[model samples]
Target: MSIPVNTTAQIWVPARRAADVTARGARLLRMADGCAVFAVGSGTHHFLTRGRPRG
Candidate 1:
């Protein structure tokens, strides 16, 4: 799927597909050891960090 320039707050996918998401332009937020977090756009920051869809 194509991620638009302005991404939404929720993007649910299996953990194994994280790399694919990143390849589609989602911003990698944090990385340590072998784990990473990604944000599709500015509006997703909270969702990425909190592990819950923003209300």
Candidate 2:
């Protein structure tokens, strides 16, 4: 499965701040046309739908 580019979707990404203790968590990210991706450690992950589609 693949996430379409330019689509707004929820994804889990590496915490951007040192204060964030969870290491990784869910976030709403706008999928980019060319650079949209999800990764952890040294591996890449795919994005899956949580519920219904968003507009």
Candidate 3:
């Protein structure tokens, strides 16, 4: 899957991959640490933050 660009820390991920930032928003992506990041894109938030996977 292709990762989206961070516009002023704005994260826009695909639908099926949005789960990657649903909850684990910061953990998944270091840059988004401690920020008001919301799911502004499509996709199922199923696989998102299921388990804390340390990168």
TM-score of each: 0.29, 0.20, 0.20
Model 2 residue-pair collision total: 0
Candidate lDDT scores, in order, read 0.42, 0.34, 0.37
User: Quick one: best lDDT, which candidate?
Assistant: 1
lDDT of 2 by residue, 1-55 (tens): 2345544443443333223322233343434432223333332334433333223
Report the number of the highest-TM-score candidate: 1
Candidate 3 on 1-55: residue-level lDDT in tens? 2234543233433332335445442334423433324542333233244334333
CA deviation > 4 Å runs, candidate 1: 1-22, 32-34, 41-55
Model 2 RMSD in angstroms: 11.2
Single out the weakest 10-residue window by summed lDDT for candidate 1: 44-53
Clashes of 1: 0
- Screening candidate 2 with a backbone cut-off below 3 angstroms (N, C-alpha, C), the clashing residue pairs are none
